[model samples]
Target: MADEIKIQEIVEFLLKHGDGYDADEAREAAKQSIEEGQPVVETMCLQMLAEHVLARIHDPSWIISRANEPDCEDSELLKRLLDSGASAADLALFARMSQREYLSNLGCILDGAGLYDTPSLPHEEFRIFAVNDEDQPTAMIDELHESLGFSGLETEMELSRQAERDSDNAGS
Candidate 1:
């Protein structure tokens, strides 16, 4: 309910600013939104801002264009996939990349979904962390990498795995 109101306020602000406002104004507005407990709204505003400002860059044609120019490894790889006719995996990854701004605009869904304040577990409950799906850690990591381009996921996975290992060691 509160989130919905925040979103409405953001929409109103955007409508007022329109697309003609200066970048600084947009940035300041976004900062204010986040500071006011509306991080999700702020993220949505930033995503819209990117689309408005960067629409001309890396045009949608990149999906069909070949790479002939020097660029970052990721961009070059993306181009190669496009030129070679993107595989299902590649296409999924590409879609994820494209929708990243929007998903991030919704705030950190993964973090928000985690059981941050769950009650204590029973004594018999051994400390074995499992992901939502039945996938092993590596598979989950890969899916997350494709779904969200956060470099920190791998680091977080490592830490989680280490913690599990430490717990098992302590139990033994």
Candidate 2:
């Protein structure tokens, strides 16, 4: 059987480097692990550190639909529904309903609400899975893939740059 995994070491490593990767701490951890005959522990700690950094760098919104514009197709459908006599409760239901059910009832829901002119608004499913897998000490990549709900996903790496750009755009 494999050596028992060290939870305290992993937690300490995560707490020390979860906000960002620290080369010195990583090196020290590796050195200590080697001295203590725990090479596997060192490898696990490094892998976890990399995954934590990746998750922090990527924007969660990149996986979701952009906010709908007021005059966009969906909003127009909503407007037409309101005009045709759909109650606020109906729209609220539409907003909260599952994507599959919402699409299935789209036409009837709109028509019954008095909206005949507007086209059907397309819906996309967005799932965000944040997992802390307990089976492996260095399961960061697995957790990230599970959280992202996709395999081999590409993500922007410059979060700070993106934030700066967003602030600039907002100010202008």
Q: After best superposition, candidate 2 residue 162: deviation in angstroms?
A: 34
User: Please, what are the lDDT tens digits per residue for candidate 2 over residues 91-121?
Assistant: 5544434433433344244223423444554
How high is the lDDT of residue 44 in model 1? 54
Clashing pairs in 2: 129-147
Candidate 2's clash total is: 1
Q: Model 1 TM-score?
A: 0.30
Q: Report the error of model 2 at residue 18, Å.
A: 26
**lDDT values of the candidates?**
0.53, 0.45
* Total clashing pairs for each candidate: 0, 1
